[model samples]
Target chain A: MIETEHLQKKYGDLVAVKDLSFKVESGQIWGLLGPNAAGKTTTMRILTGFLPATSGKAAVAGYDVFEQAEEVKKEIGYLPETVPLYPEMTVEAYLSFVAEIKQVPKTRKKAAIDRAIEISGLAAVRKRLIKNISRGYRQRLGLAQALIHNPKVIILDEPTIGLDPAQIVEIRQLIKSLRGEHTVLLSTHILAEVTQVCDGVVIINEGQLMSAGRLDELTSAYREKDGVYLRLKKIDNEILNLFRQLPGIDGAAQEGEEIRLEWDRNTDRREEVIKFCLDKQLGLLEMRSLALTIEELYLRIVSGGVEQ
Target chain B: MKAIRSIIKKEVLSYFSSPIAYIVIFTFLLLSGFFFYSLVSWFNSVSVQLAQNPYYYQQININQMVFSPFFNNLSIVLLLMLPLLSMRLFSEEKKMGTEELLFTSPLSVTQIITGKYLACLLILLIMLVLSAIPAALTFIYGNPELVPFLLGYLGLFLLGAAFLGIGIFWSSITENQIVSAVLTFGTLLLFWVLSWVGYSAHGLWQSVLNYLSFFEHFDSLTKGIFDTTDLVYYLSFAFFGLFLTHSVIQSRRWR
Candidate 1:
């Protein structure tokens, strides 16, 4: 479990994170969605006890990050954006060192290291120097080090930044598997990753908390204007005008072969329009539902001046 | 204590895992060994021929050949080698982004600093121990005073520790290791020259300024005097540097 109350981090005249209050419950993947320079890393650093908040408080596993940072650290593992690693160290050596520093029990350190390596899919590169491995493997090594301690919470900042698509999927799946074992706070600018992996999404922008809710809630909330596309074989201009003049029809736009109709927010006029077309002896081919994506909602929240 | 030991062990292992420790120790032995043998041989030839002139030109032997030459050369060796050893103490972590990893771990700032300091001291100890071979060889041919040698080494180790602390603090303030090394070398050069500059001052002011010099106390150590004041002075210097390092790291968290 992790929580922040009005968390603020300011460096002189610049504010990096402001009033970011959120709680992450156990066995849930909480996605922190924000563009670059949106204070995601700053928030993660504060919660991980690497940086101090300018005001307010951060807590991890019931321990205050400021007052009891050591205890907080004991309960959490953090993978910074760059995935800090020693290039000269072998994967096993690096993980073992992380275990030692994380205070993993001596008797269980080996098992912990092996389990992390397996989870990160780094067993093949366990004996190689980190510098010799590819970037994807290095990222996995970073994840392995963080997970070696089996902390109650794991905070990953941009876990998949430079990897190719396949590696990204593998890492995403690895992170997905951690859902039930640890409370995960994953931050990224990638919208689709949140939809695929995270249970809840916390959208932030320009160092401000924008919105926080379930993934479906964000998508459904953004599904405000349900427009239907209709492709007809033949229709007279008078018939088109009459259909457009329907009381429920908010607006209409026509392409060469297809016509798109817009209704008042969430209003469905598809059935009426279809019946009208049938009554007028106009042929109909296709109809479908269009949903707004998380990206559109993110842009709306940031640009529409909706302050959270 | 466990955290401190873990950090210390990791730091030491990091040194051996690379070639840094070997390079530093090798260069230390090469430079100090060459200077030691060359000076002892030159002094041996002069002392043998000019037995009566030994006490006649007492200033020349003690100031040039015996004390000043060796201590000055040893200080230069330390000046060159310490930055190489200490420049990576915190700067590399800052550059690699591992400082976040270390700071966010369940270790106190004191534990981290002390571990790093102990690792640096261990490296200094290794260099000092190896340099002892040439110091012992000096006695094989000449009647060099063992006490002065011991005191000089103690002073050098303490001075190196203090320099390391300063270098580590400098490393913590920035992510540039080259800049850290240059700044450390520049500051140490200033400290090295301050004692000679103190020699030019007049009256009570000269004596007071001399007391402030790094080598003023160090010179007494190389003359076979184990002054407690010199020990306290070096200890304070090292402690102050370490304290400043701790403060810099803690302040960085807020910034």
Candidate 2:
């Protein structure tokens, strides 16, 4: 539903977004993962037709963003980083205004507002002025405004930046519920958010694309070797040295009573280690493979371990 | 058209929902009323003095002595007050980060500008209509020429429109309301004083300065003379201001 090719945006001498390219399929939740100043917001603004790319192309819902901005705008809902709102307006009135500006059909405007209010859990504060609402409520109101139009694509910039733990969980659940219905492209620096809510991720750093793929595919593709974590009842330096001296075992480190063993990919040294432990009467309590979490993968990619 | 209407409705609602609309209207009415009262009293005293001499009485006319200066005083009040009406038109949106919402919407820059311009015009219309209450009192007591009185109001509305145009343009260029208001007032004050400087200069400089001065065109309209030149001047001045605002906002997207 959204695509960009060689999309570059430069503010005078500074390039905010370099030759970046990514695609999001229909009804798929894709997270644009990057640290701050990684061109995430700039990319969203260009895709939403809010800013013109200095060079390259972007399209949303099969319409060229620059050539058919009005059509693209009508087909997408955008929530900026700051959640632009009028403090004087009531929540319902604000939503109604958004619906009108989004060009919702007059006959269905009320229904649309009600649905948004219901979805964002804003019914209780519907009549309250925006300035009087709490921060979490204001955040929900921002999401409600973006969803009020029921557009094909929803682009959110830092949707959960300043929320409490409970509010963050509620927002994450709300976004997860949007799966299979709306094509969501939300940007965030939080790695866990992507693992929890997104089907795929496009990670960028310093205004360049570092990696992009499904979560499982990215984890496996970036996994370089196999690691087995072994917890033994009686682990000592002699046992760790013997394990290190074993063939096919690349490295071994003893952690208190546990031994973490590393080997070449596609090798199983657990049998050899077990035999050696049995010969020495070392008690083997537990053994498990160490899988790389998204947090580690994100840190690796963002810290320049992998660049694309 | 619907987009423009939505913007206008929202802006008008915003104006009324806050204390801005009430304060501006009340202050405008009070100041205009004060000017009218003092101008009328001064006119009444002078007329009473001239009543004893038939020659002086023949030269005295209510429209000439009262409503013309009344419109001029109203223009000064508008010059001061219209900036307050327009300072927040685009500045508040920028300051509050709502410009992103507006720019990302399907509405064009022209539509947004026109809607806001028309909304401010509506408020100006209301202010003028209410100020007319004091002017209408003149009809009850004396026989004033109605055409000149109405023309004076036309001049004030045109002047206010021109001022709002400048104010909106300045608002678009800055995110600070105070800065916008000051820039608008400073620009309007320069235009206001241009006529005074024109009276002292000679030849080409004088005519050029006089022609460029908004006060000169507005002064002609206040005298009940509806020249197309003056009409075109006010309209074009307003159009030029809006055009500048459009260019500034459009260029911002590129930056």
Candidate 3:
């Protein structure tokens, strides 16, 4: 579990993280969605106890980041935006070192390292120096270091960056497997990754929380006011005018042979419109409801507003 | 403490894995031997009486021809060698962004700094050990005083520790290891040559500057006297460097 209240971090004239507040519950994956310079990395660093917040309080795993940093650090494993690795060290050696520093029990250190290497799909390159490995392997090695101690909360920043599509899918599956075992919070600009892997999304922009909720919830909340798209077979303009004259049917637009109906949200006229169409015997070719997408909702929130 | 030990082992292992440790030891041994040989040549040319009191004469002989010149030359070598060992300790981590890993770990700042200091001390210890061969060779033709050799070696090790402390601190303040190396060497050279100016000054300035002289305390060690005050001075200097280094790391998180 993690929470921050009115957290602020300012660097001279520029505010890195504003007075932002959010909470992440146990057994859920929270995606921190933000573009570059959105204070995502800054927030992660503060929560991991690497940097101090300018004001307010943050706690990870019930430990205060500023006051009880050691306890907080022990509870959270952080993979920074740029995975800090010793290139000269072998994958196994680096993981072993991370295990030692993270204070994994002596008896379980090797086992933990092996499990981390396995989960990151680094078994084959365990003995090879990190510098000799490809970038994809290097990224996996960084993930392995973060997972070596199996901390309760795993914070990954752009975990899927620079990987091939297949590697990205493997990493996404790997992160998905960590859902209930650890409270996972990952930051990325990749919207698809969030939709696929995270249970909840927190959108941040310019050091402020733009939107935070479930994926479907955001789309539903931002759905169009009142509209139904319909394609009718050989419908005359007189019938269309009659439908438009009906109460609640504020307007209608034609696209090729299809018709789209727009109505006021205050009334429902779908049944009446259907009855009228049936009575007129105008055949309905195709009909479907429309709703905004999560991507659209996210863009709306981040870029000022969504227009219908 | 566990964190410190882990860091020390890793750093030492890294040194041995590379050619750094061997190169530093070889260079130290080779230079000390050259200085010792030069001292023997000077003694023979001057026809200094050595049969009656080989050990005392050897001390006197070394004082006139070896100690100052050797320390001066050795100081230059140390100034060059020590930075290479300490420069990468923090700067490399900073450059590679691994400082995030260490900073986010449960280890305290004190533990991190002490770990690095201990690692640098280990490298200096190896250099001192290899330099002992030249001291042992002195016993081949003269009755060498083991006490003075031990004292002088301790002095060199402590001096190296102090320089290393400075070097590590400098390294932590920058991401450029080359800049760290240059700054560390410059600082050590300043400390190493200050004694000459102190000895040349007049009146109260002499006393005040003498107290600041790094070489004066070390010279006492070469004279077979392990002065507690000098030991305390070196320890305090080393502690000061570590303290500054810890603060530098702490402040870096803000930046």
Every candidate's lDDT: 0.84, 0.92, 0.83
Residue range A1-308, candidate 3, lDDT tens digits: 88999999988889999988988899899999988999999999889998888998998999889999999999888999898888778888888888999999889999999899889999899999888999889888888888889899999999999999999998999899999989999999988899899998888899998877777777766665666777777767886787788777878778667777877654566777778778878787676664565677788888978532
Instruction: Give the candidates in order of TM-score, highest first.
Output: 2, 3, 1
Give TM-score, chain B, model 2: 0.97
The residue-by-residue lDDT of candidate 2 on B43-156, one tens digit each, is 999999999999999999988888889899999999999999999999999999898898888888999999999999999999999999988989999999888888889999
Candidate 1 lDDT, tens digit per residue, A201-257?
A: 888887888888887877777666777777888645765687679888877777667
lDDT of 1 at B238: 83
Predicted candidate 2 versus true structure: per-residue lDDT over A1-308, tens digit per residue: 99999999999999899999989999999999998899999999999998999999899999999999999999998999999999999999999999988999999999999999999999999999999999999999999989999989999999999999999999999999888889999999888999999999999888899998888888877777778889888777888888889899988997666788988877767788778878977788888886779998998898878654
With a 3 Å backbone cut-off (N, CA, C), the pairs that clash in candidate 2 are: none
Off by over 4 Å in 2: A237-249, A266-287
Q: List DockQ for all candidates.
A: 0.67, 0.81, 0.70
Docking class of 2: high
Instruction: Using lDDT, rank the candidates from best to worst.
Output: 2, 1, 3
State the fnat of model 3.
Answer: 0.83
On lDDT, the leading prediction is 2
RMSD from true fold, candidate 3: 3.4
Chain A TM-score for predicted structure 1: 0.89
* Candidate with more favorable, higher lDDT: 2 or 3: 2
Q: Could you give the candidate ranking by DockQ, starting with the highest?
A: 2, 3, 1
Give the lDDT of residue A118 in candidate 2.
Answer: 97
